[model samples]
Target: MERNAPVSRFGTVEVEDLPDDLRERLAPVVERSGFTPNIFRALGRRPAELRAFLDYHDALMTSDEGLSRAERELVVVATSGANGCPYCVVAHGAILRLRTKEPHLADLVATNPHGCELEPRQRAIVDLALRLALHPAGFGEADLRAARDAGLTDDEIWDVGSITAFFAASNRLAHLFGLRPNDEFFTMGR
Candidate 1:
C-alpha cells in the first residue's frame, strides 16, 4: 500500500488503487467531505471490512429515532478525545461542530465534557457514555437508571450505549493503526 497522503502509520490505499466497488463507495464520501478520512483509507486495504464497517456506521449514525446526530457525535468526541484517539476527535469533532452549529463545542466537550455547559439530558447521556467508554468495568445498571431519570427514552439511551461501544472499537483501531486525521478535518465546520 502506498499512501497518497500522509494519513496513517501504515501506508494507505489510495482511492484510485481501490477496487471498483470500494472506489464507488468512497467517492461520494470524499466528495461530501472533501477528503478521505484516514480510517477509510487504512481499512480500504481490505475492502470487505471497510464496507461492513461503513454499513454498520451508517446504520448506527443515520437515525432519526434515538439520539440526535449531535449527541451521537458528542459521545464519540468525548470518549475518543479522552481515549486519545486523535482521528475520531478531529473527524467526529468536525461532525459535531456541523451538527450543533457550535464551532467550539467539540473542543470543549472532547477535552472536558464535565466542564461544558450541557443540558441535564446531554449531561446524563455524556456521563453514561463516559462510564462505559473510560471505565467499563465500573459501569452499572444505575448508570442506565440515571440516564432514564434524566429523561432519555429507552431507545435514546440504547443509542448512547451502542454509539459509545462502536466508537470504542474505532478508537482502538485508530490506535493500533496509528490513524491520523485527514488535514481537512481540522478546519471543517469551523
Candidate 2:
C-alpha cells in the first residue's frame, strides 16, 4: 500500500497503486476535500471493506427523509466524543459546524451537550446519541419515549441510532489504527 501523503497511522495506499475502481472512487473525495481524510486512507488498506464502508456511510449520512444533515453529523460528533475518538470528534465536528453554520456548536456539543445551550429537540437528540455511545446495551423503551416526546419523528429516531452505531464502529477502527484527523478538519467551517 503506497501512501500519497503522511496523514494516516497506516499510510494511505498511494492513489496509483489502488485498484481502478478504488482510484475512481477516491479521486472525487480528494478533489472535493482538498485532501484524503485519514479514515479513507486507513480503510483503503482493505479495498473491499473500504468500498462497502463508504457505501453504507454515504447512505446513512445522505439519506434525506430521516434526519437533516446537521442532525446526522451531530449524532456522529457527540458519539465520537463519548468514545474518546479525537479524530472522529474533530472531523465530524467540522462537518457539524458546516451543516449547522454555527462555528461554536460543534465544540459545544462535542465537549458537553448537556451543558450547551441547545434547543430542547437538539438537547434530546444529542443526549440520546451520547447514551447510545456510552451505554448501547442500556438503551430502553424510555429512551425512545423521551426522544419522541422531544419531537423527533420515528424516522429521525431511527437515523440517530443508525448514525451512532455506524460511528461506534468507525471510532473503534480509528482507535485501533491510530488514525489522526486531517489538519484541514480543524479549520474547516470556522
Candidate 3:
C-alpha cells in the first residue's frame, strides 16, 4: 500500500527569520492552532510588519470590544467576500461558523446577505460592513446612523469599521502575495 504525502499549505520560516517578539507571541498560537495561519507565514517575509500586523490583529479581534466574536468574524467574512479575497473569506468564514455554530452562515453571508437568517441588527451590521468594504469613500454619517439604529453603540460601530478596514488591508495583502487558505479551513466547524 502506498502512503499519501501530506499536503503542504504553509511555507517554512525559521525562528531566527522572525522578530524575537513575534516568534515569542506567535509560538503559542501556532502550536494551539496546529498550524500557523498562512497570513502569519506570508507576513513573516517581512518580520517588522508581521509584528505590527499581529498586534493590530489581536487588538481588534481579541479585545473586550462591543462586537461579539461572531459579529467580528461576520464583518471579516462579509468584507473579505466583497474584496474577493478567498483566503480571508475561507478562513474567517470558518471562524464565523465555529463561533456562531451556524454551519451554513458563512456561505449565506458570502454569497448573499438576504440568504442569511440574521436578526435585523445583525443584518444592518453586515450591510454596513459590505458598504465599507466596497465603497469606503462613500461611507458617511448615514451609514453610521444605520448601524446606530441597529442598536450598535458608537464604539461598536467603530469596532465594525475597524474590523472591516483591517480585513480590507489583509485582503489586499493576501491578493498581492497569492495567499492560499489552509485546506482545514474549508470543512472546519461545518
Candidate 4:
C-alpha cells in the first residue's frame, strides 16, 4: 500500500533546518510516530503559520474535553472526508483504527456513513462534524441542539466543532501545499 513519495509542492524543509523551538517540539512526535508527518514539513514552508497551526492542533487534540481520543480522531476522519482531503482521511483514519481497534470503521465513516455500524451517539458526532466541514456557514443553534440531544456534553460538542474547524483549515493547507499522506499511514492498524 505504499504510495509514491511526496514531492513537496511548497518545497522541502528538513527537520534540521527548522528553528530550534519547532525542532524541539517535533522531536517527540517524530520519535513516537517514527516519522514527521508531511503536514508538519509542508506547513514548515511558513514557520509562523506552522507554529500557529501546530499550537492550535495540540490544544484541540490533546485537550481535557470529554471527547475521547478515538472520538477526536473520528471527527478528524469524518470531517476530512467531507473536505475531500485525502491526506487527512488516510492519516487520521489510521489513527482512528489504532485508537478504537476498529479497522473497518474508518473506511465506513470516510466512504459512507450508512455503511458504518456506528452507535447513535457516534453517528450524531460524525454527522455534526461532516456538517461543519461541509456547510459551516449554515451551521446554527439547531445543529448544537441535535448534538446535545445525542447526549454529547457541552465540552464534547465544543471539541467536535473545534476539531472540525481545525481540520477544515488543515485540509485546505494540505491541499494548498500538495501534501501527501505518509506511506506508513496506509498500512497502519490493518
Candidate 5:
C-alpha cells in the first residue's frame, strides 16, 4: 500500500492494484468523474462486496427509474444528510448538483431539506425519504397516501423508499469502514 493513499480503518485498496474486473468496473466512473471516488478505492478492498454494492447502486440510481437521475441523487443527499454520513452527502451531493444543474441546491438539501427551496414534489420526495431513513417503523400507509397526494406514482414512491433504504445501509457501511469523502467531491459541481 502506498503511504500517501487514504486509508479507512480497515485499510483501502488502491485502484491501480485492484483486480482487473474491479478496475474495469471503475473505469467509466473515473472517466466521467475525472477521478476515482474514495468509496470505490476504499471499499474496493473487498472486491466481491464492492461489486455487489456497485451493482445495486447502478440498478437504483438510473434515470429510467421513476425518479429522475437528479431526483434519485436528491434522495441520496437528503437521506445521507439525515443519516449523518458525510461521505454520501458529499459524494452524492456533487452528483445532485451536476444532475440538477443547480450548484447550491445540494448544499441546502444536505444541510436541511426543509430549509431549502424545494418544489412541492421535491419536498414530498425528500420528506418521505427522510422519514423512511430516520424512522422506518413509522413509515405507515399514511406516508404512502401523502406521497400519492403529492403526485408521486406508486413507482416513484417505491423508488424513493428503496433509494433511502439503500443509502441507509450505505451510510452505515461508511461509518463502519470509517469512509471519508474524497477531496475531488467537494468542488465537483461548483
Candidate 6:
C-alpha cells in the first residue's frame, strides 16, 4: 500500500494485486471518479464478496427500475443518515446534489428530511425509507399505503423498501469497517 493511500481500519487491498475480476470492476469507477473510492479499495479485501456486493449495487442503483437515479440516491441519503453512516451520507448526498442540481439538498435530506422541503411524493418516499432504516420492525402496511397514496406504484414502493434495506446493510458495513467518504465527495456537486 502507498504510505498515503486511504486505508480502512480493516486495511485495504491494492487494486493491482486484486483478482482480475475485481481489477476489471474498479477500472470504470476509477475512470469516472478520477480516483478509486475507499469503499471500492477497502471492500476489495474480499474479492468474491465485493463482486457480489457491486453486482447487487449495480442492479439496485443503475437498473431502470421504478426509482430514478436521483430518487434512489435520495433513498440512500435519507436511510444512511438515519443509520448514522457518515460515509454513505456524504458520498450519496453528493450524488443527490448532482442529480437534483440543488447543492444544499444533500445536507438537508441527510440532516433533516422534513426540512428539505420535499414534494409530497418525495416526502412519503423519504419518510418510509427512514422508517425502514431506523425501525424495520415498525414498518407496516399503512406505510405502504401512505407511499402509494403519494403516487408511488407498487414497484416504486418495493424499490423504496429495497433500497432502504440495502443501504441499511451498507451503512452497518461502513460502520463495521470504518469506511470513510472520499474527500472529493465533500465538494462534488457543490
Per-residue C-alpha lDDT of model 6 across residues 70-187, encoded as one tens digit per residue: 9999999999989889889988998899999999877988998766798887898899898888788988998888888889999998898888988889889888887878888889
TM-score of each: 0.93, 0.93, 0.89, 0.94, 0.94, 0.94
Candidate 4 worst ten-residue window by lDDT: 1-10
Clashes of 1: 0
The global C-alpha lDDT for each of the candidates, from Candidate 1 onward, is 0.85, 0.87, 0.83, 0.88, 0.87, 0.86
Residue 109 of candidate 2: its Cα lDDT? 83
lDDT by residue (tens digit), candidate 3, 105-182: 888898887567888878988998988888889999999888888888998899889999999999998877777787
Q: Residue-wise lDDT of candidate 1 within 80-165, one digit each (tens)? A: 97788888998999999999989988998888877889878779978888888888998888887898889999999889888889
- Report the C-alpha displacement of residue 170, candidate 3, in angstroms: 0.5
TM-score of 2: 0.93
Better of 1 and 3 by TM-score: 1
Lowest lDDT 10-residue stretch of candidate 6: 1-10
Clash tally, candidates in order: 0, 2, 0, 0, 0, 0
Please write out the lDDT profile of model 5 over residues 13-100, one tens digit for every residue. 8788899998888899899888888888777878989999999999999759598999999999999999888889989998988888
Error of 3 at 186 (Å): 1.2
- The model with the greater lDDT, 3 or 4, is 4
Candidate 5, residue 88: the lDDT equals 93
Runs of candidate 4 exceeding 4 Å displacement = none
Query: Per-residue lDDT for 169 in model 5?
Result: 93
Span of 10 residues, lowest total lDDT, candidate 2 = 1-10
- Per-residue error at 93 for model 1, in Å? 0.4
Model 3 has an lDDT value of 0.83
Cα TM-score of candidate 6:
0.94
